[model samples]
Target: MNERRTAVPPLIVTQDNSFFFEGAAAGRLLIQRCADCGTLRHPPGPTCPQCRSFEWDTVESSRRGTLHSWTISHHPQDPAFEYPLAVGLLDLEEGTRLVADIAGVPHDELHIGMPLEVGFAEHAHGAVLPQLRAPGASRTEEGES
Candidate 1:
């Protein structure tokens, strides 16, 4: 048995963002919302910067967003990742921005306002990661790479 195993990136779960990971495993994109002021925050924190409120709750995101910004990495920071990786900040319709790896789109085709959707990338170590994918980016032209 010479099965090759790929390494999965580690996920740091804390009390603040545990719900985000749990939602990822369940194929949902969750965001932290301030219960008091109804303000939404990403990279979940204990206090809302807007309202400075400790009271918070979770909300399932629409999983749809526009590419706010992006950078294509020709260099792989880790051996587990591939080169020329595309990363983008998704501006969710919920009025929050999410930074995640963008997939299923060619490097040259990426635009600042391009639409993307959330998807879960299953890891070999049983971790599910949230990633972005092009909504309708299939090649229909003949001989298109």
Candidate 2:
């Protein structure tokens, strides 16, 4: 039998944000920091909002964070993701917030201020990306239990 697979979206990697994707592929979490004023930012950009400096560097995050907010997405289902998907906004210990998919935790168990850790896994399209999981939880590359 011939089996078909869903096409997963690809990440838009640019010079300004390549490090973040590279870090995820390497199982490391990196955050962008403004070299001039020591300000950190996410969704990597070309200039620091605080200092307006073009120079920047990366810091390795602890991957430890607290769930600041979250949501369950079930509408307009996409083949790339599972239904009732748990996504969250996390406040990393490094002081920057990141949005990532939550795995291995039941939605009812998720709460604001709950501790979480970032994990890397292969998403659709064979892209490695960050995922939020309970501290010490182990997940396969496919992000299954």
Candidate 3:
């Protein structure tokens, strides 16, 4: 049987949120945090959602979290979604929740409150997308070099 190997996607350079693209490309998961209230925020906004303060900082999470919620998507929303994808929300250890694609596992095996880790999906367009995986899960043989 052949295994599926994942690749790194190209990056899209933009002015404000370019760091997100770069971080995904490098396999690092990054999110914005409010320096004032120490609240974690996703989508990289300029202001803190909790304190509504402009003081913010870039933070890298451990990429480990629990599955908050999820859904299996068989329909392709875009041409890039060629395979069956699991879209999920991860509740990070830092009290932040992030929306990402869950990979490296079958959709039936996914469960709420399951431990998850972060990974990067390399797209052909050079833009990397963040993905979630079961704890200690590895790619298939096709994914290996």
Candidate 4:
């Protein structure tokens, strides 16, 4: 995978959330899918909120999403993050919305309904992340209508 320059720290993954990180390492964006109701959920968990079932699994995302909302931080919260950091929400095609750092687009230009794609940024400690980017940044739409 190509190196995506980023300064944020690697995300911590535990027994409950290893699937997301593992998928990131393998260069795929993964989200939680309800084994019973077939609904997708982000920030993966043990129970399906839709079906109230304890059964769940991972689904590799379409890696395509639309920018829903955002707030750029002019104040530096962490030196690891660049000034004007864009922390935003994306509504994925699979019906799940996730919060992640939006990259490859000027912070000031971000707005609602902007097309986006995923890029994997490898952390210094070796964990990978699913960072957001513009749709035209060499990403192909696969199996997504």
TM-score winner among the candidates? Answer: 2
Reference-based TM-score of each model? 0.83, 0.89, 0.77, 0.81
| Candidate 1, RMSD to the unseen true structure | 5.4
- Residues 1-145 of candidate 2: C-alpha lDDT, one tens digit per residue: 1232665556788999999988988889999999999999998999999979999999999999999999999986767778899999999999999998999999999999999999987777666889999988743443664
- Among all windows of ten consecutive residues in candidate 4, which has the lowest summed lDDT? 136-145
Residue runs of model 3 more than 4 Å from their true location after superposition: 1-15, 138-145
lDDT of each: 0.81, 0.89, 0.75, 0.77
State the displacement of the C-alpha of residue 96, model 4, in Å, after optimal TM-score superposition.
0.4
For model 3, the run of ten residues with the poorest summed lDDT: 1-10
Clashes of each: 0, 0, 12, 0
Better of 1 and 3 by lDDT: 1
Model 4 bad stretches (over 4 Å): 1-10, 138-145
TM-score of 1: 0.83
- Per-residue CA lDDT of model 3 for 1-145, tens digit only, reads 1223435244446555777778877777888778899887777777787788988777898889999999878754455555577889999987788888887777888999999988777665646777787776534422673
Worst window of 10 by summed lDDT in candidate 1: 136-145
Error of 1 at 9 (Å): 6.1
